[model samples]
Target: MIKVLIADDQEMIRSSLEIILSCEDDLDVKGVAKNGVEVLEFLEREPIDIILMDIRMPVMDGVLCTKKVKKRWPQTKVIILTTFDDDDFVFSALQYGASGYLLKAGDLDTLHHAIQTVYSGGAMINPGIARKVVDLFSQRQNTPIIQVEEESVNSLSELEWDVVYEIGHGFSNKEIAKNLYLSEGTVRNYLSRILSKLHLRDRTQVAIWAVENGYIGRRS
Candidate 1:
């Protein structure tokens, strides 16, 4: 089961999440916290696989809390929960190692899937925020171009290279699978090997590297 902790200041929100998440057989609500401080305290006492962190709270905010949690427990995945599509908060949370960013207005199915995706070493971004992320990265200036050697390119098999190319294009596992006539599990496995071979962290890094290195076409 995927163990989760919900952290939000609003009592109703917390209760609603608890109820919604409890219906999923694969998920378990480990605990609930009112704010970042309480989240930290809960972590001290429980074994949690994921955290549903709110952006704004009384004491420490989600971005700061996410940084601290990642520092202390790098294995624990965090999914930022919010009511707004604040670009600053989204970017800050991502920079702080949040595995996912989700709007609270998202349906229960989406929320459940986000938890599963993040727990499986993948990422989830609210569809609304995902467009913003793409635009933000696309608009950034002064990004240094990377020149990868032919030897590095030759190291990857054709299939692995295909996976890398798609990731560079910002396609998720499901999308890549659909495009390539492969299963999502197969795409994920290929991605795991791609990251290992490329010495990259997540798909975001892969996208940046791909663009800078010209591993994939710029306009795809």
Candidate 2:
């Protein structure tokens, strides 16, 4: 089972998410926290597989919390629970190694799937949020372009390169699998190998690298 922690300041949201997530057989709702501080405290006592974290909180915000979580507990995946108004915070969390970005308006199925996806070593981005993130990333003039050599790029096998291009387009593992006519498990394996071969930390970095190196094309 994938162990999960719900982090939100609102009592209703935390309770609702805990109840909804507890219904899934594959998901185990380990605990709930009211803020980032509580989240870190929970981690001190036990290890968790994923955290459904709210972007805004009282003491420490989700972005800062995500950075600390990644730094101290690299294996614990975090899925930012955000709204459309939290564009800047969302991007900041992604930069700090968050594995997923999900809207509070998302359905139960989406939430459950996001946890599973992240736990399985894949990244998930809500489509609407993804488009905005891509646009925002492209607009940053100070973002340094990553220069990947042809030889380095060619080191990835053809199938792995296909996975990289799909990730660059911000396609999730499920979508990439359907488009590439491969199973989701295969896509996940390819993504793992791609990150290892490219010396990247996560798929978010891969997406940014792909855009910087011209591997990704404009999406409409």
Candidate 3:
């Protein structure tokens, strides 16, 4: 089972999420926290597989909390859930290692699938935010351009390269699988090997690297 923690300041959201997620056979609600501080406390006692985190909170915000969680407990993945689509929050959450970002206005089913995707080592970005991420990432002039050698480039198979290109376009593994005519499990395996061979972290890094390396074309 994929153990999950709900961290939000609002009791209503926390209770609702607990009820919704606890009903799933493959998902378990490990704990609930009112704020980032509580989230840290919970992690001190036990390990969790994923965190359904709210972007805005009282003591410590989700972005900072996400950074802490990823730094101290790299195994734990975070999915940012929020009512707002503020660009700052979007960029910060992804930058801090959030595995997924979704608007709370979306259906519960989308949220559930996002959890599963992230738990399985893929990413989920809301459609609206996906475009924003591409635009925002393109606007950044700070990160240096590092041209990968042909040797490193040739290390990945054509399927793996296709996965990288899809990831660059912010396509989730599920979507990539459908488009590439491969099973979702196969796409997940390809992604894992891609990350290892490329020496990158998560799909977010893959997305950024794809943008930088000119791998993402207009089709992407």
Candidate 4:
């Protein structure tokens, strides 16, 4: 089962999400927190696979919390589930390594799918949020690449390049494995090595790097 933590400032939202998500057999609503501070405290006590975080909170907001979570627990995935979809919120949260960004208006099914997708090593963005992300990153496509990063790109094997291309398109490990005719484990191994080579923190950054570096449109 996918272990989860719900972090929202409101008591009703926290309780409602806990109830709704608990019905799923694959999901385990491990705990709930009133704010990021409590979320961190709970995490310190136990391991959680995912965190459904709200953008705004009392002591610590979701965006800063996301950055801290990623830095402290890289394996723990975070999905921003909130009513706010402002451009700054969308951009900063993802830039700080949130695996997914979704609106609270979406159904439980969408939330569940996002959890599974990010857990399985893919990134998700709400369609409206995705457009803003694309436009934002597209602006940086013309930015110059330094020699070191260019050399790092050159160091990747053809198979690794295939994985990068798939990641750019937001394919999960399962999808990338099927598309490349490789095993899922092999795809994961490729991904790990790619991250090490490129000095990227996670798949989210890889996707952004792919788009900014022109991997999306050129895919064959």
TM-score versus the correct structure, for each prediction: 0.81, 0.88, 0.85, 0.87
- In model 1, the clashing pairs are none
Ranking by TM-score: 2, 4, 3, 1
Question: For model 3, where is the 10-residue window of minimal lDDT?
Answer: 141-150
> Which residue ranges in model 4 land beyond 4 Å of their true spot?
140-148
Of 3 and 4, the candidate ranking higher by TM-score:
4
**Worst-scoring 10-residue span by lDDT in model 4:** 139-148
Best model per lDDT: 2
lDDT of 1 by residue, 41-144 (tens): 99899879999999998899999999899889888999999876576776667766788888888888888888888897777777677656666656653553
Candidate 1 residues lying further than 4 Å off, grouped into runs, are: 143-158, 168-175, 183-186, 207-220
Q: Which residue segments of model 2 deviate by more than 4 Å?
A: 145-151, 154-158, 182-189, 212-214, 218-220
Question: Which residues of candidate 3, in runs, are more than 4 Å off?
Answer: 143-158, 183-186, 212-214, 218-220
lDDT (10s digit) by residue, model 4, range 38-137: 9899999999999999988989999999989988988999999867446667667887889998998888898999999988777887777666667777
lDDT of 2 by residue, 41-158 (tens): 9999999999999999999999999999999999999999998988668657887899899999989898888888889777888988877876776787366434445666778887
Residue 99, candidate 2: C-alpha displacement in angstroms: 0.6
- Candidate 3 residue pairs in backbone clash: none
